[model samples]
Target chain A: MAGGFAESGADLELVGISKRFPGFTAIEELDLTIPAGSFFALLGPSGCGKTTTLRLIAGLEEPTTGRIYLGGKDVTDTKTYRRPVNTVFQSYALFPHMSVIDNVAFGLRRRGIREARALAHEALKLVELDHVAARRPAQLSGGQQQRVALARAVVNRPALLLLDEPLGALDLKLRRQMQIELKVIQGDVGLTFLHVTHDQEEAMTMADTVAVMNKGRIEQMGAPEELYELPKTVFVANFLGQSNLFTGPVVSSGKDSIVVDIGGRKLEVPRERAQRHAGEVTIGVRPEKLQLHGAEPKAAAGTNVLGPGRVTDVSFSGVSTQYQIAIPGLGTVSLFAQNRDVGAVLREGAEVWVSWDVAHGFGVADDPADGPRFDPDDDTRSIAVQRREKLEAELEGA
Target chain B: MAFGAFGGSPATTPASDAAPRRGGLIALFLLLPGAAYLSLFFLVPLVSLILTSFQAVDPNAFEIGKFVYAFQWQNYVDVVTTYWPHILRSFGYAALATVLALLFSYPLAYVIGVKLRRFPLLQALALTLVIAPFFISFLLRTLAWKQIFSDEGVVVTALQALSLLGPADHLTGTPFSVIFGLTYNFIPFMTLPIYTSLERLDLRYVEAGGDLYASPASTFLRVTLPLSLPGVVSGTLLTFIPASGDYINASRDFLGSTDTAMIGNVIEANFLQLQNYPAAAALSIVLMAVILVLVGAYVRRSGTEDLL
Candidate 1:
């Protein structure tokens, strides 16, 4: 794997890197190797070390331990200006006084590039911003200024391009547009792109390889689809997409699957998924994989396992209908059903059977290292959404 | 009609009726004292000066004029030409003194304003030193300089010991000594304003320039110097205008008849010794006009009238 990645000539290797600021650890034992010409994303919640890892790779901060390698050379102690890397800050950080063309030419000018005016004109044309070449940053819209910053960094053709939440400040529509634009630019330049973001949808769409980080450590790293489908850790499962997790114990083990007795219901899930100590386990299933049927299946069809549940809530999305079902012994489980037409409507408080293919259900091994069991009633809502509400209420109070 | 279309009207309207009542009171409070003071001290003295300039001095040395109708216009012409060299000498000394003061003060001001911005104690020390020259009386300082430059003075004696001085009356009473005195006296005026302007200058521009790959020297020349022009021009004007009218340095350092005799000495001589009030007034008027014209052209050339 390392050899295949290295021959591409722009591999970025971060080894045993740890950064600490006084009492806070920003990055700990971070080891990641990104292939050349790949769009890689460091996806995490806020303050989970995604931005810190980007800064470390850019040589803006020194790691407490280990080394960073760019193009197969150790560049752990290199100065930001001397390194073959550039960052597009979230604020755009365009020089306010200079024309857009000059802003693009700033790094080149520092390197004593002759004919800067002509070269800057070319870079602007690359970003499709040549029309605003003579305008200052303040005169342009937010999107135009962002394009200028992008052009400014790529004009150097550095080995690695670091983007620190570069699209966090833009509106959703603009962000989606810029995402396609960034991918195209990275493909054209053939430089290693390391993007940091807290938006899971953004990471899924833009990144070829998405690394999910939590509390300064990567929980999983793989192709976007691979990570989303077979997320080994509960953190990765909930972070990448919506998951309805059920905790219980393993009633029996099979050749290729395990039957988990969740509350009182038995679930036969993929045995290859995660380790099961033969007692306690949690089963995770994607909401889209779950299905609801009005009639119970025949008990003789042993391969197709089923359980009865009542529809507690029904939410209408534009193209789909989402149902929250409460099992007799199990907690609420969410399922998304395709909305074929207006006639295909499901009412709340209606009895239904919930079932899924064994392949779709993954058995997460119980953590033996855990000190104690978590209360089922513990709040499992996303901390990010809760934080936003808390901040809004505090602002209103103030 | 355009004003009416905009809903504008005068005292017949309620808003207009109340505005003047308050404005009239404010006008009386703000302008009354200043106007009365200018009428008494400024205009009355200026009118009297004009009256005296036209008067003739009798044999008994008392000036007399009947409506100043018997104007001696020749006195004006005589003063202009007779003391022309002395007037030029005063201006030359002043210009040289201002230049020298700028040279001595600019670096000090730049250091205080730009480098020591966080240290208020350093500024306090500089302020104390700036006003230290004023602590000594002007006459006493000039006299002290005279003694120091005398043949038996410490400086000349040291120079003689070093075999750098010629026979007698070589160094003292020269134009150089007069300029030195003036620069020493007016150094503070040149420094404080330049320091103020430089202190208020935002340093972000310099960093921005540097990030654009311009060297530090280029940054200073292109960004720092152009932005600090107002300070330099003001400091130069402050030093130049006052120093030009100052002949005290020249009169005291040069004694009776030296190359350093300036316009102030000429004016003083005409007033006391020759008892020629008209000539003295004509000379004074000419000096004021010259200073005014120079300052006006400078302000125009600098394009900093509003800044002043």
Candidate 2:
């Protein structure tokens, strides 16, 4: 790699950042530190302030109250052009009037760097788009334009690279391909990348650290596996992936585990996995971690079991069969079973028990605001119908 | 009765054939009014003017308006030679006015379109003020300016007080007053198009420029200006084409004197006072041809022909 293409990365720090517009706050008092040469992802739904954070770091937006430090140097008041940062905007924002090569060379030329085009060519080659260097951005496909945008920012060799939902416009297949390419390129260049996206899968597949943002706050931040295996908050648990949650009071606290009374049944949660062990607590287990049995098997030690409930729905995807079991007092729980035993596909209305290892059950403080209300009407509607209605309501509210 | 009616119809008639034929008939019918209006008002007059340009004055006629139908091609040559200075002066003044208007309107448009975008009410008010002048008559506006620059008017007196103009130097009926009137009257024309283009400009491109390490001025030079060239081209065309052939600002009754008489004034004088139909017609044709060539070259040079 060329020396100009692989400048050592600088760490970014945002201290007490708060951004407020006319009526609403975009980002509340938030502090985050991104280590040098780390591929970090800020994962959040829309309106969660992840993009705002990225903009603040890029100097496109100034925090209402905060200091921004890059490599331990305070740059809070620096102009966007003076900051050693570049961003791949969500829309690509490629200059339509300029050719692709010119677009990539723009930052280099602005910095008065010699051999700007040669450097731009090398950057384009890194993205595997050197062949289309002479074409305009409008002439390229969405995936091609995305790479061009990446190359344009990467060529600058800035201390930090901010990607704001950069692959949001690509198709699913193309997005998957670009995710891998982006990781490879990030490794090759070794620049600190702050990727802001709403797609949890994209974040988990690429980022070294994923921060789940909700309502202008970072609910949880950790490695992808750590976050998935054990989320710290209800928002993080629900937003990252599907989590089957059972909320109840902690009936007993022991040295190594805490027993929670969930709807007449008692479940044991590991003490280390539980964020809180007193008052009302919500224990969660991932769908894939839970195993479904046709009948009550022999009680295994270190196992938490639920549901001598009837199966309400069974959906057979290519690789896995997802089953929804409706317990009498508790609501329906989702379970994903890998297609290892094809002949053992359980039918709807079958009485089944869902069980998981006690270590797999994680606990978080019960969030009453987002807790599922058990509606008598919910039993009549299928899970898919309920999901669609919830989606419609959310859309209307948005 | 329904069965008999259906059975009597031709079963082999292709439904697609009748539909397209009917569609074609409807399209032709829809195009009739506009085509007829153009032919009657525009095409007929144009052909007549072209024919008149080649006619000769009849010496044997008793009336002043009488003309002889002949291929008198020398009429074009005669008008060019006799009024070449007036033609040159028209173009020069129009070009100056267009440049001046652009210089003034670009910043105004940018302020209204880009800067005030956050304050939409203010932007709308600014745009309304730009367009509000159209409610008044164009002639009245020029006359208003003529009054403002009169010898005894406030502007001339102020300039005299500042010693910028000599005591005897008047503002009215000079080249300055005439060109100024053209620019002022057509400023809205120049501003509205440029404003529209600037308003539609996606600001992310500008932000990208800043992110790419270009300073504010450099970003404008490298991005904003080039992207808004389409608007500039159209704005200049809108101001230049009419300003070049406009007689009101150059007429003796308005801002001009004999020294500042343009091709439009000459054409008006030839047609109305001198009754020289051929010369007037020839001048009009020449002006149209020149404006067409100028605008074409400009659009081509700006590389915004695709936009047109």
Candidate 3:
């Protein structure tokens, strides 16, 4: 693993952290270490425990049984006010009554620090909101309010910063811009940021290290590229981005490679990615990893897997062209390609050859009843929220 | 602007620049009826009262009790000298009752709105209890309190048993009992508005305050209290204005003695017993003017002009 402040010691630690509400366990048996000064993200879909994990670190919620350490001190039993941590809430939560400067300097004034206004001015300047310091939060635009929230948290200079979907309220364009700005500010300030987000793209763009959480446990933790390319579970593979999976019994296992036959066609996968499976496995490749050609291509040196297919769906998504291809024997597969130099747009029913390198194929333990990827955007506290919503809809339907 | 705040889509968009203008026009139209009512009842009475305050009482020139409005401006000066103690006492009692009601209701509202929120049933029950006072007649409720604080009632008997009060001392008709009656009767007024604001308060700001290293007290004072000020302002106005002009609660027949008479009691006596309409009108005008000025100053100081 790469080393830096992460090796210096964990800035925040949670050991055996679990939180149980009256009806259900929100988070269970979770242990995580956010390296000092690293931009880390807890990424998952709406019902995942990523947000719960962030709340535990911010001292907003106490664990049912666990210890929380901040900068090498055990703060498990400490009050939230005494903990050296701060959070930028999803709603911004700026004091609607106070001016922007008062909102930003609130922590310092509580700490009894002299020259709080000066410090607040500096923090606002960092977010480029100093000019509007005298205005109330209600008077500011959404994006500006979000910046004030960011400034308010950073001004405290806490040992660790927790951001709970801090950019969730902004428009898509503003969210994209703030993602860049957040990364820059995290870099400049060098504060350990534990960002919780459901947006995979937001996680990938801003965090140096990403931990994809599901239910209440960490599914995978690594660099964004590693999690995207070498996902260990079907949930992680599909949740990070779209994936094409080939489920079949493993025919051969190798030190350098593994051979799996799919629909009477043999495809080779690199052995390094196949170590997690034994019997039945699914070899997965990302949609963008597959290359398409008009004619059937011969197996090349690096591209050991190749197949002929017919396009079932051709979707033009501005930046990339998405095509759903149906192999003769295989069910269906998805391929994404840059639209830059396309000679002609591929229409539905067009025949094509799809190929990818052995390195792109990774294995995951195949589950019998694997469903389609769940990517709902309306995030709340619990996984059962969706189920309850579905039940309510059904009751209304009748 | 109602739809604009929610951000209208291009498909269903109204005229952008004209939205707030149209909204304001509709608001004006909606306000016209209430404005007309206030002008007819409140504005007309107030103007008549101001004119009547300057009238002279010529007892025999008219009937035994009637008089022309002789524009005697000295009526105000004569009433101020005559009833200055009653005016001061009215304000003092109102101010004390307002402060007491605030202290009592804030914690109640906070607990109901924030602490008990997760228990919807309990929050609903608590809120109903707060508003339950309105179900009973106000006069009956004050009478109930008068009974509770009577010389031989449980409260005074307990105080005597505890040696906290002398056997001869009684709470039936004192300044304390009058203030207590005002506070008890108007508590719901102070609580519900504060509860409305507190109910909608985002707990995230409290969490944010804690995250910023503020103690619980600090968070309450700086965040919770300031955020709930709009409610506090409205609640105090609702409680104080009516309490100052309340004759029934402080009348000798109720919980108060003649010594504890407020301005409202004096006006009642002048209008009913003495049949002195000019003096009552002058006192009523002064009371209204005082309340308006005080409430105006208060709302301005609280920085809750949006509420007013």
The best candidate in terms of lDDT: 2
Candidate 1, residue B164: how far the Cα is off, in Å: 15
Q: What is the C-alpha lDDT profile of model 1 across A68-167, one tens digit per residue? A: 9987888887655567677787777776545788778776776677877787888788889999999878899888888888888777677778888888
Model 3 Cα lDDT, one tens digit per residue, A55-123 = 878778889988988888898888888877778999988988789999999888888888899999999
Tens-digit per-residue lDDT, B185-245, candidate 2: 9899999999999999999999999999899999999999999988999899999999999
Listed models, DockQ each = 0.11, 0.55, 0.49
Model 3 quality (TM-score): 0.90
lDDT of each: 0.77, 0.90, 0.85
Docking class of 2: medium
TM-scores, all models, native as reference: 0.63, 0.92, 0.90
Clashes of 2: 0
TM-score of chain B of each: 0.84, 0.90, 0.89
C-alpha displacement of B120 in model 3, angstroms?
A: 1.7
> Taking the tens digit of each residue's C-alpha lDDT, what string does model 2 give over A104-200?
9999999888999999999999999999999989999999999999999999888899999999999879999999999999998889999999888
Q: What is the TM-score of chain A alone in each candidate?
A: 0.88, 0.92, 0.89
